[model samples]
Target: MLLAMDRVTSYYGKTAILKDFSFGIEEGKCLCVLGRNGVGKTTLMRTIMGLTDRSIGDITIKGTEIGSSPTHVRAKLGIGYVPQGRGILSEFTVRENILLGTFARHDGRPDIPEVCLQMFPYLKANLDRRAGLLSGGQKQQLAIARALAVDPKILLLDEPTEGIQPNIVHEIGETLMTLNRKLGITLLLTEQHIRVARRLGDAFLMVDNGRVVASGPMAQLTDDVIHHYLTI
Candidate 1:
């Protein structure tokens, strides 16, 4: 497995958000985490990245235990995260924002990865522009580019398409598909749009009230299952 969590229960302060949750994604495949809002979908991604205040249970990446590791350690272990709100530094220029990802590089190279620029031509063209000035979709692209700069073995994306224009959402989905199918980067993403999940994912995990209520291959994500766990 590229990433696996065994019985992980994540807490923010004293309140538990994810309870006894376990799931895994294989190398070079995309696993879509599905659920309605406020169901701990984002918490699952944060837990894997070790951003929660505290967590119990095991998290392994490439068979290496990372549950006890710090957030930077997890990033150094080849986990790149594009947070839900597109956590780019608003005051930084595009170039500077992307440069931040290189801090996690094992090679210590500070240069922006060529793949990041190639993947998002807009960002390449506007490297000097302040990230805050970009449109919502453009900022999303920048966020993904920054994460790719980590040269990760696995990328964790939370709500990649939220609050974006429909056309841009489709574009982002296509880009992610290329990354997964051609470049062979493993992806774990939480998505509210079932259509996007169906288009991009090889596998699926359904979360509800912080637990894995249903999970299987994309083909096994039947309408019955969707209605039961995903419909609001």
Candidate 2:
């Protein structure tokens, strides 16, 4: 397994968010995490990256015990995260934001990977453009590009298609699919769009009230599962 969580619980401050959550994803598969708003979908991602205030239980990446490791250590272990809200620094240039990901690389090299430039031509052309000046879709592209800069074995995406233009939603979805399928990068995506999840994911985990309520191969995620756990 590329990623595994066993009875993991996470909290923000004194309040509990994810409770005894457990799931695993193979080395090259995409796992879609689904839930209604405020159901700890984001928390689950944060917990894996060691961002929560505290967490207990096992979180293994490639058979290594990372449950107690710090966030930077986890990143160096090849976990890349594109957080919710496209957490790019507005003050930085497009190139600078991408360079930040390289900090986690073991080589300690500061050069931006050529793949990042090749993947997003717009960013390559606008290397010096301030990140705050980009559109929603552009910012999202940059976010993904930054995570890719980490040269990760697995990518954790929190609502990668959120709040973007309808046409660009499809474009972003396609980009992620190419990364997961063609490039062989593993994906752990928290997504609200059923269509996107169905297209990109090999398996699904439906989280509700901070626990895994339903999970299986993508073929088994029927309309009933959608209505019960996904729909508002």
State the lDDT of candidate 1 residue by residue for 1-232, as single tens digits.
8899999999999999999999988999999999989999999999999999999999999999999999999999999999999997999999999999999997889999999999999999999999999999999999999899998999999999999999999999999999999999999999988899999999999999999999999999999999988666
RMSD of each: 0.7, 0.7
- Report, for every candidate in turn, its global Cα lDDT versus the true structure: 0.94, 0.94
List residue ranges in candidate 2 displaced over 4 A: none
TM-score of 2: 0.98
| lDDT per residue as tens, model 2, 1-232 | 8899999999999888999999999998999999999999999999999999999899999999998999999999999999999899999999999999999876677899998898899999999999999999999999999998888999999999999998999999999988998999999999989999999999999999999999999999999999998767
How does candidate 1 score on lDDT? Answer: 0.94
Q: Each model's TM-score?
A: 0.98, 0.98
CA shift at 110, candidate 2, in angstroms? 1.2
Clashing pairs for predicted structure model 2, backbone only = none
